[model samples]
Target: MAWAGLQTALQLIYPPRCLTCGGMVESDFGLCGPCWRDTPFIGGLVCDLCGTPLPGVDDGVPVHCDSCMTTERPWQQGRAALMYRDSGRRLVLSLKHGDRHDVVRPAAKWMAHSARPLLREDTLIAPIPLHWSRMARRRFNQSALLADALARETGRTSCPDLLIRANRTRSLEGLTRNERFATLMGSIRAHPKRTALMEGRSILLVDDVMTSGATLAAATEACYASRAREVCVIALTRVANES
Candidate 1:
């Protein structure tokens, strides 16, 4: 396998060092046992609608957050691995800026394990698209990489061009929630040629980090607009308690 060979070569040169503690490790993902265990894995009392961890599963509030209650998301449902803590932040940063594509496997494996029951043979896995300029600048889309990893792990087909970013907007950092939503509205659209395949099909939208749910909401709207029956989002991490 190419990844195995690559891992071998990388180990031979740089050796494996844990991302959390910088300790020697056998794997190429830069994670040590203690750090891996310390990584916050989201479980228990999760929302039925968006799958963000809820305070109680059967508290009888119907498992929707304040944001979900106020705003309608076109996606059918969604789930994320962990809250946006330091560990998740470091993992995403490594994948995005440190070129640590190796993290995709472990991250996507966890996502796939959680998403298996939600996926079907006919389900289409797609990644949230980056603007062309952003993709060119980064030379890769972290979402696409995650989608590919999920597809390989789950035996699903990943359609890279299904969803597209129509326009590039300013970063949402430091922006108010309303401003973020306004800037994100209609920023994504289904690729014209792939519109036919979208109708009446279930899609799993893959993203690395979700904040304010703005980007996922916009992508879900575009998918629904393309006539998709159901869209479910899966992300590595999400901003917790953003109500």
Candidate 2:
């Protein structure tokens, strides 16, 4: 009962609070009710390739967005837990910039639920890596934490360094798709010693957010270069707007 006792003492020391408003919450890692109501969780219909919300006319069948229909994604499939807006934005910011370690468990649980369709028993879970410069600033790669938690939940192997960010790329905030391509073209590579773990493997690439998707795209290329048989992506949240 030491673990239980420790949990009780921790709870007493730090009462649960909402990640957004700092109001007391029922659990240690979630938003309050109003914040929960405001979250744009991605459920129901979404693009089969990129997990963008669809128009809801397909009656739950796999459908592609106009972008996915015209263009191809490097990964075979993708899923996202929420649209990056409202409380969804707060959740991501809390985890990534706020140093809210409490949010990882809840976020990972949501991601695991969203990614269940793409997961296989043998699939390898990996995180999009941070460049050394960025990692030194952030102190940790948030994606690595999520990838590790996802691996635990699914009983899959988590390869935190399978894809290494060899170089840092400029922020993709307002870049067009073509411009984004040039920016992230050679930013990532498969780790030399760990590439063998990816040979002919199905990989589930994890990340905190899919903004322009440049990061995931570059990471996917790294995985395929290592002879991974297939790759699927699961972002905790994704940019909601096409722009």
Candidate 3:
């Protein structure tokens, strides 16, 4: 009782701050009221494949977004916990470059909750890997950290070694779909030693953000090449091409 009370007192003295704005929040890894409202949580009727927010609803039928209609997505289903906008960008950038390891657990909890529909009995949770050079410079792979947290929360196998980055590509931002695909082709490959583990298992690819889905597609190609039964992609944030 004394220890619990002392801990509560300490918490009151040093209240948890919002992850986005650093304002005092009610809980750890949470947001203040304004920040909470500002967050663009990706919900509502979304695209069946790319998970982009749709304008309206339908009669329980799956609706494909404009990109999905013309472009073929390698993953079976893609979902993002938040729309990559003001708050989402800040949150992701903080995690990616700011070394904010505290954000992974809560963010993964949100991701696991939002992507629950894609979870299956034998899903292997994996991350879009970073090349050794990039990982060395960054000191960590943010996607791998999130994947590990997500696996712990969802009770899936965290398979960081399932896919390996064979080569590094330039930033895909501002590139067209074809250009992005061309750059990422042959960049990612499944680890030969662990390829057999993915032979008949479903894979849930976790990442920090999804912009053009190029990385996920390439990673999916690698996973499928190893005979994985299914590949699904989910991220903490996704760049919404439209409203």
Candidate 4:
């Protein structure tokens, strides 16, 4: 009962606040009702390959989105927690650029839910790596943080340095699909020292956001090159429509 009393006293001094809006909430790492409703959490029927929301009901069958149907996704399957818009966009920006480490916990829980179908008993969780130069500028890789938290949540092993950027590439922000793919091709590879860990193992690649999926494709190919049995991917958010 002492712990409970201490918790209550702490709450009085520092009440839990919503992750997105900073409003008083019943618990930490959660959103208030209005923010929760506004957040575009992907649910219901979703694409098997990319987790884009679909129109039909989920009938225990996997389906693909139009983009995924045409695009060549190297990973066996993929999922995402949110569409890159509205509250979802805000949350991603906060975590990615604003140094909001507190967002990682709840975000990992959501990613874990989306990744249920892609997980396995021996799955290895790894994050899409940033170039050393970029990592130096950012001081932390948000995807790595999310991947580590997700591994803890799912009881899986995480390797933050499983993949390494082979060369620095330009930002893909304004690039077309083909441009993005070309830029990232051969730019990522498995870390030499860590390649043995991926031998015949199923790997789950984690990323903060996926736009054209070029980065994910590069990471997936690296896993395959290292002889991983299978690879899947999950992102915090996805750009549903490239506009």
**Cα lDDT of model 4 by residue, 1-243, tens digit:** 999999999999999999988999998789999999999999999988888999999998999999988998889999999999999999999998999999999999999999999999999999999999999999999999999999999999999999999999998989999999999999999999999999999999999998888999999999999999999999999897863
CA RMSD, predictions in order = 3.2, 1.7, 1.8, 1.0
Best by TM-score: 4
Flag the better candidate by lDDT, 1 or 3.
3
Candidates in order have lDDT scores of: 0.84, 0.87, 0.88, 0.95
- TM-score, each model? 0.88, 0.93, 0.94, 0.98
Please give the lDDT score for candidate 4.
0.95
Better of 2 and 3 by TM-score: 3
lDDT winner: 4
**Residue pairs whose backbone atoms clash in candidate 2:** none
Residue pairs with colliding backbones in model 3 are none
lDDT-wise, the better of 1 and 2 is 2
Clashes of each: 1, 0, 0, 0
Q: Of the pair 2 and 3, which is ahead by lDDT?
A: 3
Tens digits of per-residue lDDT, candidate 2, 31-150, equal 799888888888888887778887656485788887777656899999999899988888888889989877788888888888988998789999999999999999999999999998
lDDT of 4 at 156: 99
Instruction: Please estimate how well model 2 matches the true structure, expressed as its whole-model Cα lDDT.
Output: 0.87
- For candidate 1, lDDT tens digit of each residue in 1-243? 999898788788998788667889987655788888888778776765566776754553447777778777777777888677878888888889999887888898888976754687678999999999999999999999999989999998999889899999999888876888899998999999999988989999999887778899899899899988888888888787663
Is candidate 1 or 4 superior in lDDT?
4
